[model samples]
Target: MPEHCAAFSCSNRRTIASRARGITFHKFPKDKDVRKKWEVALRREGFHASDTSVLCSHHFNQGDFDRTGQIVRLRDGVIPSVFSFPVHLQRLEKGRATSSSRRAEESLSVASQDSQEMATSSPQPQPNDVNISTLNVIS
Candidate 1:
């Protein structure tokens, strides 16, 4: 079992022997930009991720979980950002980065917030609305 979580200042260890029953590990996203977002949220030190670097379930929101208690299958372009670091942990987790890196993180955070707002503010589909494809075809 892994010793710790990969999220910034997260120390939660796997509690169960079974991989399916306990805290889960999620690999860094395949997309480079998305992967960078995770790294920025981590706010850690000397961290360079290779192909297999992972963040555990504790860092992700409950919505990211599946009914089986495993991380859900993510849709294309989805990214995880439901975590928060403690104040003390925040101090401990700070890592040095260039100004460009800082700007990148700030922009990422703002853009994510804006997108989330748009998603929630959008109207839900009406149940009564039906598409022509759903009706029986007349020959």
Candidate 2:
């Protein structure tokens, strides 16, 4: 039987797809001290792990995986410290944007199309849109 993730709200199980994707299930540390540390990291309340309990690879960092040879593996004594849990909320400001951001180039193209339609539709703003008070004050 495949082992399911022991993390709270995570049900990732070891399967063919996961193995193909190089995602493996991690068994809890055999040493009692290490196991205690792992429990602290997982931070699950009122959950006790059995001998067969495991955690999925999603909780681990990319650096924890060793891909030097043909097959990828976890480095020995590599405790999982880089758990993302769900996701990291980040600001998508102008200069802080990442390549993996949700913004697509398609939106920009659509905006350009709207701009072109506006150009062909009308060249001037409505009379009401102009600041008549400011203009009279300037005069």
Q: Name the candidate that leads on lDDT.
A: 2
Task: Show the colliding residue pairs in model 1.
Answer: none
Candidate 2 stretches greater than 4 Å from native: 68-72, 84-139
Q: In model 1, which regions exceed 4 Å deviation?
A: 1-3, 13-21, 66-71, 84-139
For model 2, residues 1-139, the per-residue Cα lDDT tens digits are: 9888887677678999888886778788888887887787776766667899888888888888888997657777677665545543222356425654435665777899999999999867776697666665644
C-alpha lDDT of all candidate models, in order: 0.70, 0.75
Instruction: For each candidate in turn, give its C-alpha RMSD to the true structure in angstroms.
Output: 13.7, 14.9
Summing lDDT over every window of 10 consecutive residues in candidate 2, give the lowest-scoring window: 87-96
Clashes of each: 0, 0
Quick one: best TM-score, which candidate? 2
